[model samples]
Target: MTDRELFDTYRRDVYYLCHYMLHNAADAEDICQEVFLKAFQTDRQGVERIKPWLLRIAVNMCKSHLDRRKRGVLKELKHFLLERRRDTEAADEALERKENELETERWLRALPVKNRTVMTLRYIHELSLQEIAETLDIPPGTVKSRLNRGLRQMRRDLGKSNPNLKGAECLE
Candidate 1:
């Protein structure tokens, strides 16, 4: 596929990754745009691996943004944009789903940065072990270990915050 075509196909996934990584939709959109722009500016050889390359760029952008970030920017942006959606019955369902998603997101946000990234890349983005290893520049074995450890941490946290959820047993 051509660069634009591949980029279009993967755009939502890239945005989702950025949103998950940054924990804010607006910054995610910004990073997604930046990643695509970087891809567009790349040479043909670089464009050949655009999916993983774009993910790497998005990851780097989130990391940079996090490292020098001001507090509440992400939260304020999220709250500001939350009520601006179109009104409809289907939109109500969507809003409900968004609520659940946001709750899950809050749980994720409480985790360590590395665990959050690992969970987002492994579970949300649905990347293969090798692809995640490539994107994170880590070994496949390490990715697996991180996945296990992250899940364990998430379960423990969830059990504490959610009265209905039992730690680790929730997975069963």
Candidate 2:
């Protein structure tokens, strides 16, 4: 495919992936541009699946950007503080929050980055396990393991507190 055609076809997908990973629209746009630029410059005649290839670039770039920000060290503390703050909300606000959220979206945000990426690619983007493995450049086995572990972690962490959070039945 021509560069413009490829870009037009997958731009939203690439942008959504970067947005999902970085949680920042500007940064996601920047990374999405870089992904397309890099893909355009590379010789892709041998690539069997262009979308997965593009996604692999996006995943790597997002991970690199996250590493540069050095927020991994603060992730645990931030998660803890956010949880504490949310727990102090009044019942009315919490009820509003629940009403505003989709059950899966709520649980997906509660997961770690690795598990979140795997789950997002698998569920939200509707990629097959092998496609996800290619997109993330991991073994299919690793993808399965993350999905499994993510399910358990999501349950153990959020299930007891919010017994009504019930959208995780398909992550297996």
Candidate 3:
């Protein structure tokens, strides 16, 4: 497929992967552009599956981006921690929703890169274990192991933060 066609087909998937992986929309957009640019430059003669191949590139790019921006991410984390909630009833509901999203984001970000990537690809993207393996260039067993370990870590973290938190058991 032509570059335009490929971008059209995979843009949303690529953007979503980058967004969830990075938890930043602007960074996601930049990385999405870079992904297509890299894809356009590379020859795809032997690539058996385009989606997995593209995702693998995105994953690598996000990892690299995260590594380079470790300080910035930490700063953002601090900002999230310092942010205060509003007190109005309407704001309370909105604040609750935002808090839930922030909590989930924090949990995902706390995971190691491999574990985070595997979990995002498996749950957010809804890829099968085999598909995650292919996208991550790892064995299916590794994918399962990471998923289990990541879930365990998330559960542990949540329990420590909120003892009454429900649905954590469903992770197992």
Per-model CA lDDT versus the true structure: 0.70, 0.78, 0.79
**TM-score for model 3?**
0.68
Residue-level lDDT tens digits of model 3 in 1-172? 9888899998988987887667788998999999999999999888888888899899889879988987234211212322345444476687776777688878988988678778777776668898899988889999999999999898989888877667745343
lDDT of candidate 1 over 67-172, digit per residue (tens): 7784322321122223445354486787786886676777667666666677777677677887888888888898888888878876776677677966456664
The weakest ten consecutive residues by lDDT in model 3 span 74-83
Query: What TM-score against the true fold does each predicted structure earn?
Result: 0.71, 0.74, 0.68
Which should have the higher TM-score, number 1 or number 3?
1
Regions of model 1 farther than 4 Å from truth: 24-26, 44-49, 68-100, 161-168
Arrange candidates by TM-score, descending: 2, 1, 3
User: Which whole-number lDDT from 0 to 100 does residue 57 have in model 2?
Assistant: 95
Model 1 TM-score, all chains together: 0.71
Clashing pairs in 2: none
